[model samples]
Target: MADPTLKAALRGGEFIVAPGIFDMISARMADRMGFAALYATGYGTVASHLGVPDAGIATFTDMVSRMSRFAQGTRTPVIADADTGYGGLLNVRHTVQGYEAGGVTAIQIEDQEVPKKCGHTPGRRVIPAEEMALKIEVAAEARRSDDFLIIARTDARTTLGLDEAIRRGKLYARAGADIIFIESPESEEEMRRIGGEIDAPLLANNVEGGRTPILPAETLKAIGYNVAIFPAIGFLSVARALEGAYAHLRRNGDSHGLETYAFSDMNELMGFPEVWEFDAKWARPERSQAAE
Candidate 1:
């Protein structure tokens, strides 16, 4: 089946809510829970896979592998983070092609320098706006499908200023970016300004405990954002739940309250019935008849 087009889906007034997923399990959970889409978050990937920060350490290959897992494991549209496109314009082209082939519906690139820090974090630098714009143009052309989107992220809001971020956002949009993302908008006023100033569709990075306020999708839509991604929420929730489960086990030497749900519940959640049905449908006919 063809992948869902995130660009076309976000054209309407309602904003798309994409929960951050790092691994196939999270992706499956999001898909089963009926999220509109999935954000293959770089921060989540680095933390989950590498036990490190999103400090530009995740190479293009790492992102491609993680993105491919989500794309193949779930049917939901996935928006992946291609941090700094992993290098220059040529690198951006290569990264775009890999992500597109991996089944991602959209890729988000930022203007931060190599070894880049997360947008909400401090002590980060960006490349020249013109250079980043050129990268965006190359990424726009490299996609195999026109429906595959390029989201241009500008970290200038905290580094340069809101004005500079707006300028960079416009430059990226003119360079053919499908969506404009001004990272780390400090307040509601700045978000409103970004939404009002940028001509193209806007993306809101709604990180938990990040610089941006944790607002609902409706509020972000009213502020003019077409898409909102909660990049670390799922990972954070999973970590906390695991911490509690392990702590309870350590205290009691056995799972007590943590055993509220049976192992069968988890099996059902993971679609064990579907696997059995597939086995029954595809097993050898003679063997099936003997078993019957």
Candidate 2:
């Protein structure tokens, strides 16, 4: 079943701030931080897993595998991005079921065409709003439980305009989406308009360098957004950290002076203590048997 905690939080009227987690390290780290949820970001996952862009090249299997790993490894409820549902209506149904079975608490599906680009980027196109509404209906029906939420995203704001995006958001919500995400509203006023117009729970994309102006959680909440996902923060920070560490190593041949996550702490975070305990328990019995 889906994690009821996420659904409860959404109903609780508090704004949720979900950080993007792309890998086990990110997942485990965020899992302990007490965030309301973790977003298994499609862009970060594709880049980290396949060394490729999030340009619809990653298949359903590729994305779902990562989603399963994230959900299994982390205690926090995960909201995974299912880009374009990977195909048509049948694909949408299958994707929802696959994600639910993989232990994801929620899945965000967009209205973009196949070969979908990132929401904040250009050259992206969306299918008909009616077609996307059907996709949402199929997704909602395919889930085994209502707790497994369906977040409907419209990429129409950047391409068609804010008016069309809002229209699609309302349509998708009526079609059974639990949350409406009108992606990439450029200004605070546009966001406010979205919040006032769309009666359903809304999601704001808070990409650092993307088209949307990054708002404080309080501002987002006051603007009537229920969730704000910072999908690029973790990976972008990691990228900079790696660059600095690698540059230092190349120049000075040592990482001794640099600040880093303690090696032992990392081992513990990754569950090495359990492995050690198991080894110790088994080794003692084997050694005793040998002596006997």
Candidate 3:
């Protein structure tokens, strides 16, 4: 089921800005930062977990297990990417149930066919609008609670055109999608048109260096987006920091003068203090005898 807090926030009419988090460290960090929600980015998660690209290679089990960890570990509501629902209508039903059971508040299912590519990349193809509408219907019906939102994404903007994408967005909304995502709009004008045309809650993909121009939160709200997800920012920033740290170590042959997160802080962040307290309370017989 969805987090009641997030569901309420959606109804409050404020624009939500969700940062992407791929791993526990990122999730924990974002949870502490007090965002309205966190996006479980498929590109970052697949790259971090499997060290591979976001091509349709990861299976449902692989993705859902990670989603479980992310949703369970974080306090913020999680909106996960369930790419193509991992298969047909049956798969869509299973995906919806599994994600909701795993504590995901929302699941994004795109209209891309099997072996789907990243939204900003070329050579991507979408299934027929009617077919994707059925998947949306199955997803909406499968979720146990109305709070568990179904985000319907149409990738037609990249391949077909903005017009088809808008049409499909309206169709998906009619099919019971809680949120509409028309992926990879090439220009700000196109985004404005989407916001103007689509009546339901609209999602904007703010992928840095992608086809869509990354706009500020204020501008996104003025353009009438209900939510904007920065899916690549966290992982891309981490990747750059890692590259720099590794390059410094490689050149110097020893770690010195490199700016980094404190080791002690990391220990606290990972809950080592709780483990130590548990050890003191239970693992030491002397402490128990003394208390007695």
Candidate 3 segments exceeding 4 Å error: 285-292
lDDT of each: 0.87, 0.94, 0.94
lDDT (10s digit) by residue, model 2, range 65-170: 8999999888889999999999999999999999999899999999999899999888999999999999999999999998999999999998899999999999
Q: Relative to the unseen true structure, what is the C-alpha lDDT of residue 57 in candidate 1, on a scale of 0 to 100?
A: 84
Per-candidate TM-score against the hidden true structure: 0.92, 0.97, 0.97
lDDT of 3 by residue, 115-203 (tens): 99888889999999999999999999999998899999999998899999999999999999989999999999999999999999999
Single out the weakest 10-residue window by summed lDDT for candidate 2: 281-290
Name the best candidate (by TM-score): 2
Clashes of each: 0, 0, 0
- What TM-score does candidate 3 reach? 0.97
